[model samples]
Target: MHLTTRQLFLSHVVLLAGSSASALAAPASKTVSLSYIARLYSMRTSVSGKKVVMKNKWNNIEVETNSRRAWVNGVMVWLHHPCRKAGGGWAIRELDFKKGIDPILRSYAYVPTKKPNMVVLDPGHGGKDPGAVGTRKVYEKKAVLSIANRVKAHLEAKKIPVRMTRTTDVYLTLNQRSDYAAKVGADLFVSIHADSAEASSANGVETFTMTAAGCDSSNYYGQSGDKSTKRGNQYDAANAVLGFSIQSNLVKMSKRSDRGLRRARFAVLKNAPCPAALVECGFLSNPEEEALMIDPNYREAVARGISNGILGYITLVNRARK
Candidate 1:
């Protein structure tokens, strides 16, 4: 799909919605029709086979019937629950609308009241925990720490106060990371790490926010039955905005395959004191990405991507305040 320059710009506008609160309060067991969403956004809707497509001059949303997969503006986003048939129409769960779609579509209503005063950066793994080990002895912990330091430099250059959970090769538990962020009064938290999989072909970058309450994680793909709520669920909307920002910038800067924004219930995210996102830079198990992780230039690119993402989110919040 081709997008004009104006359309691209419109996709980034963080506008407000009038009935966001009521829409968010819809029951978890209930579903919202795609037609309603189209009307809310002033977009036209059509059905082609199993997919429902909604589009305006500026943006487009495509959702598969009876599936959790969706695409917004050509970017794939995983919904918390699958879309299903409701009254002869396709609909998604209320939680998915509140935590996933609405925030991405209208972030101004979801942003924090104040601009972020401080950002806490957590580099995954440390001394005792090697994280994912790749070819040529490349370590995920070391790579992420280097990247985090670079990101700190970029953010600090822009006069943004930044702090890290650990500066060196020291192991810290997940609880300690979240606790430290809370103690420091962080307005935003970002955890960085590389991924690993048995299949070396699994490559690309993805960002994760806290999974909504009473929903399965993106990784589980609706298989898990865990529906427990977490403290981080309070920032579900903000998480989506932040995650989308990070993933969008990261993919643009790294020029990597877009794995889309996703959701998970990691300890750091589930207990985060503020809006948070966890970024998987790339898969260490993939030979190509593993090599790229060890390169200084590549690391710089990734850092710039993450820093720009944070700045983008801050800009949205500042705009919302105005």
Candidate 2:
């Protein structure tokens, strides 16, 4: 976490051209078991007769009815935000089941394409969701919207039709956003967010996909309260792959700290009909990075980084189709 300036610069270079996941898997001095995930299977819970099931393929994590929330390795996740303690249980205000979960059940599944079928751009933290707080008193929502607009403009220049969930500051319900993508038949969905951490030292760019379902039993986060099944795993795996490709490119193009790809049962990613990713541009909590993010030049760079990543995914898909 204590990265020197040179080290940070090196991380950027390697992020763009080196440090493949396999290479980063070099034996470590200490055992880094993922507690966030390991605790899911052991999680205490109460069941509502009502149940929701979710599958995310990126880290092969699946949640069935009565599932407890947890993070997935190789995926980016923020434990405290959106979901916070309510009563004796945890609930994410941004992901209320009524608006978020039900939509996934009714939405269409997206097929992979050489070119994106349609691109759905989500500017994170509309309405009451302030997203991450920054060091210079900057709000995550404002910075992301700037980047999202630029990304939209650039994509449109490429003749790629783009749809924005919220073009202005208006609050749109999570269901409405997801439904919009499904309605438009978008091929890919990208939600823009800025990262913040307790430590200002945590500056970086990362992308996230849906959690994978087939994690080894040992890897289960403590979600003991849930029932499990195979059909869920199949659904999660297919989508996770698409999420992975976008995230991999996102990390590469940004050339920031490799937060590594992550999986979570997020509303936007979970409900979007096509491959979707939520990208954290960088940590606005860091003083230096906060200044950078506020600058128009740096904001443009952030937009370009996201656009490049998407284009890379598009090229990969097109090549595979041949």
Candidate 3:
């Protein structure tokens, strides 16, 4: 199923909206970022005779289609914005593919599945950024990249199309990464990183959503008299849903100390157009955790944990939509 550039771009724009970094102006109003366009292009797949489903982990948007028109269940929901090209094509935006669209389709609505979308993986703190340095002199950028590569390998082995924000030790501005993701129309965005703490005892794994609405800085008590601060805006709520689900799944799989889900207005989450999450695999500042992270075997476990979290969220989202 070969896709034209326009169809590919449209799907990515929708997917990327969930995870794309903020500050991208409307498409027609400003120059579209090339990376954004590239991302949209990267996730494109041929849909002919292939099954396509979409789930908005944030909105519980589920929709499925065989071909031609899309249906929520039996009912047809019109596209918010119809594609002018491809003979007046329609697309389902960042929503759950099967379940989210199920109820609507059950209502006898038109549902169409154009193509299968791809996911985006980002390894944080690369090149000049260097992210957070660990007490062991481990570079956050290099460590995250290693983890990200492992993740890419695992996903590809499953035949799930994947893209990396940076496959090498190159530097990319937050906006550039976000804009590119927006353009790519990624279904989901996962940014990998190693955590650092002021105290070595502060070791654990944490996942983050953009933030919950109306709650900028809620102080949650931690074990060491530390207050957990979660921050974001209303725009981040959906991603927050995705974050919690992913974080929970990660804890269950890795058996790591659950730092729980946090909210930080990081560029990766704040500006993303689609649901996005940043994972602090473990505290590099902690000698035990840092030593483990440096090991190839442990890194594989971390990647497996991350992958499980993502697939778990996807599964839950699909089930909920149903």
Candidate 4:
């Protein structure tokens, strides 16, 4: 009742062809692990069932299976695809590694930053614009101003040279902020705000760099066909370097959820004159995080984390230059 050898061989060939066609129809993804990545870059790593932690002299990464999230240094980053189990351990899609993770790692360790000094800090929403509202009526604009002021103090204290679009409570349009940054010849621009969502359960620290050419933004519906460069497009690599530097520092020290690096085209960032990013420090709607943001001490910690991230980025740039 068994088929002859020739018949069996023909059946196998048909199965192989079908499998190949199925693979071709879907997004291509190859399983990869921390050790594999570490080997490629000569990094030291440790592994557990759910997480892969990699470290070198200058950076760190934490990848978790099925989490759709990873931590590079201290910054929490969202993966394009969740890690999958392979060979009895956690692994990431090859495409995600190459496009999402590798670029960030390389820039952190090697990219030469154009700006050694001159930073423009924009505290998001002021005066008429309260941005997000939280329990106890905590206005996001007020909290952000506090954080931005502290960040400014820290940067200036470090001799990095600082300027803010608005020194006092008043409304500055996104165009005004971007224009002022250009007028002052900024080397970098950082816009800081707290986040809010309809889902109260959502809480975390997320950082956003401008959307790159031919890439969909963090917001899924962002179009991808426009390869033409925009003002912010010129510094895509630098934006990653700067964005991750601050993000890692914040997530590491703030001890809040690491929402991950994201892409957006906010007016301030889209028209920015230099490498720019927007920092969503935490969710204003989450009660626990809301309590923290409202506290002066906790807000200081947030500032410290962001300022340290900026310093870390500066260090990367300076080291690369040398």
- Highest lDDT model number: 1
- lDDT per residue, candidate 2, 188-271, as tens digits? 788898888888798777666654332212123544432332322233433444444445455555556666455555677667
Candidate 3 vs candidate 4: which has greater TM-score?
4
TM-score of each model, paired residue for residue: 0.89, 0.59, 0.59, 0.76
lDDT of 2 at 235: 38
> Which ranges in model 3 have alpha carbons more than 4 Å from their true place?
1-116, 218-237, 320-322
lDDT of 1 by residue, 39-116 (tens): 999999988888899999988999988888898887778887889999988889877887788888888989889889
Q: For model 4, what is the alpha-carbon lDDT of residue 84?
A: 79
Q: Tell me the whole-model lDDT of each prediction, alpha carbons only.
A: 0.91, 0.59, 0.58, 0.81
Per-residue lDDT tens digits for candidate 4, residues 176-231, read: 99999999989889999999999999998989987755455666654655545589
- Cα lDDT tens digits, model 3, 236-280, are 434544565556566665667876566556777767756688888
Query: RMSD per prediction, one decimal?
Result: 10.8, 19.4, 17.2, 10.8
Candidate 2 RMSD to the real structure = 19.4
- Stretches of candidate 4 above 4 Å error? 1-39, 43-68, 79-100, 108-110, 113-115, 221-228
TM-score of 4: 0.76
Better of 3 and 4 by lDDT: 4
Error of 3 at 289 (Å): 1.2
Q: What TM-score should be assigned to candidate 3?
A: 0.59
Candidate 2 wrongly placed segments (more than 4 Å): 1-115, 214-249
